[model samples]
Target: MRYSRILEIVGDIVKVHVPATENKQTAICFGDLALIESIADSARPPHLSQVILLEGEEVSLQVFSGTKGLSTHSVVRFLGRSMEVTFSPNILGRAFSGTGRAIDGGPQLNDEPSIEIDGPTVNPARRVLASHMIRTDVPMIDVFNCLVESQKIPIFSVAGEPYNQLLAQIGTHADADIVVFGGMGLIFDDYYFFRKAFEDAGVLARTVMFVHQGSDPVVEGLLVPDMALAVAERFAVEEGKRVLVLLTDMTAYADALKEVGISMEHVPSNRGYIGDLYSQLARRYEKACDYRGAGSVTILSVTTMPGDDVTHPVPDNTGYITEGQFYLHDGVIDPFGSLSRLKQHVIGKVTREDHSQIMNTMVRFYAAAQDAQQKQAMSFELSEYDHRLLKFGELFQRDFMDINVTMPLEDALDRCWQVLAECFSRDELLMKDSLVEKYFPTPADTLSQVDP
Candidate 1:
């Protein structure tokens, strides 16, 4: 194979100067992979890199590993292909690096057909309208927000929050056929937490994880989402599986993009991020889709806000692309700020008949409780109702809103009613009479339960 000479090396980026005559015969395109051969030491294995930019005869590449001990005269062999990941059922229960290499001391993946990552999203015409709900068994989400299938939602959170823990819980409890996790810039502890959580929950057999640690190659960080989504798409499209793709700390992913953009000398947009930040995020989120007759792919990602700023570029841009977001504040999913845009389509239709009414009542009482707490703090005399609100609020946080609480939707709905009955009278709830009559506890009902 013919080779081109490297003209310059900066950090992980290598600039190869190709002749106009050679370019005509062997065209170099963006996203194409290449091998950098060491002329100085021919014994060393060829380093892998990808073409990130192309202008006339000057092509720039981002080396996967750092370009250390590399020379300008190194031979550049264009692979004429983009990066790909092996896609098959064998990928389940396996852990891979961001670049799709096995990193969990597992056996090497056998010869499986690989598919290119970062491809275009499935066409809208082929997508079935998302009308089904994927139950995560979390009251804050399943009851209030109602995670619809094929919907793309985010957990907008700040650092130090249990966002990763919440994600692991969801992966353990979500009812999808398979769970695909993509972690960017995660610490070793965070990575271990996910693996242990999945293993303990016995879901590891149906889960796949692609992790990019804080110390891994920066370029590999950019590939995690693509590798995850590519495999997820294959499972949904080919294997007919309901796949849930969970990504934690997309802010780190955006930071990696900014770093690469800066090295490439591209003009920065908001907060030093590349100009196409929204498009870049949308490309991945749009991969969530429901096939016509097969299963669907639902994306629930985490976009951590730096300094708890909602206007930060990562979450700011994410808000526009996702159907809705769960605001994880103070370790609880804030109901007032969280919403699911497509929830209405499934709330009453797919969920239980009383799901909507119960959800509304729970959130309403919680809001009232917050107001009562504020009134108490301001030294205002509390009404009898205010005291009840306070009690209800405490119970809500303890039993329903806590991220650790795991129960079926029906059980959670019953818990909501019990909290209401213990704190307030029947009339105070103002719920649908049919539901109140059906689920509300009465004096006799309470007595019968205690005696037995």
Candidate 2:
């Protein structure tokens, strides 16, 4: 391949001057990987880069490594390929950098074949509509907002919330065959916490982590989601494994895009983000598909809202792409804002016959409890129903809404019944008489049963 000369350099971006005769199809194409080398001094190692923009004979590239001490005389060699990562079962239990290099200090993988990152999604005809649920024993998720298989959802939270803790809990207990984790702009402590948590749970053998710490390159941060989803697709398609992809702090990913976009001199959109923010987010989320006659890929990501602003470009665009979102507030998943759009597909069909009625009733009572608490704060005269609502709220939170509460779906349902029976009489529940007869405890029966 013929080499080109570097025309200019600007903070991790290099503009190479390709000859007019260079083939547009074969050379100087967008997304093509290139190796930049300083010709004046042959000792400097070659830096990897990707073509970000092309204008006639001028091609702009974003160097994974910042351009420092490099002259205009540097030679650029196009690799004729885009970014790729190794895919194999060996990746499980292993940690990799955003660039797909082994960061776990283990032996490098040699037998795995490379798959291109950010490829087109699976065909629509090949995808089956999501019909199953991915149970993560968390009460707010499993009991209320069921996590449907192959559904794309997010945990919308702000800084300082225990979103990471919640994510770790799900990773440790979710019933997926494998978990693919991608952390963007995380601190070293957060990285260590995730690794240690998975290892302690003895689930490292079934987890793959692609971590991009805050200290890593911005370009690397942008690659984490794509790399993670690509490997997940391969596992579901070839191995017939139910895969769950978890991404933390996608807002960091968007920020990386804005940083790179500014360096590339591209026009900005709302909040100074790139114009393709929505498209970029949709491309990644759309990969959550259930392949026909094969396994499935579900995405449960954390798209943190800056200052708890839902109108932020990242979360705003995400709200349109994902099926529904879990609102993590003050270390608890707020059931009011949290919803699963596809939960209806599996509620009664796959779950218990009482699942629908119980979920609605619990939420309705919780709303009433909120009003009762507000009335108490104002020193309003307390009525019998108001007093009962206050009692119901406390028990519901302690037994079910607490993030630390871990129980099976059936147990959670049973616990819900116990809470209702303790606070409200049989006639006030407003539930079906048949369901009440089967699940709700009579006064005599309630005296025999204790807190679960």
Candidate 1 local lDDT, 1-452, one digit each (tens)? 44656777877899988888887788778999999988889999888899998888899999887788789878989888999998887889999998788888988775877999968888989789889988889889998999999999999998899999999999999999999999999999999999999999999999999999988988788999999999898898888999999998788999989988988889999879999999999999999999987879999999998899999989999999999999998999998999999999999898888888989888988998999999999999999989989988988888878898888988887777777788888888888899899989886665554210
C-alpha root-mean-square deviation, candidate 1 = 1.8
Candidate 2, lDDT over the whole model: 0.90
Worst 10 residues of 2 by lDDT: 20-29
lDDT of 2 at 369: 97
Q: List the residue pairs that clash in candidate 2.
A: none
Predicted candidate 2 versus true structure: per-residue lDDT over 276-395, tens digit per residue: 999999999999999987899999999889988999999999999999999999888999999899999999999999999999999999999999999999999999999999999998
In model 1, which regions exceed 4 Å deviation?
A: 447-452
- What is the lDDT for 402 in model 2? 81
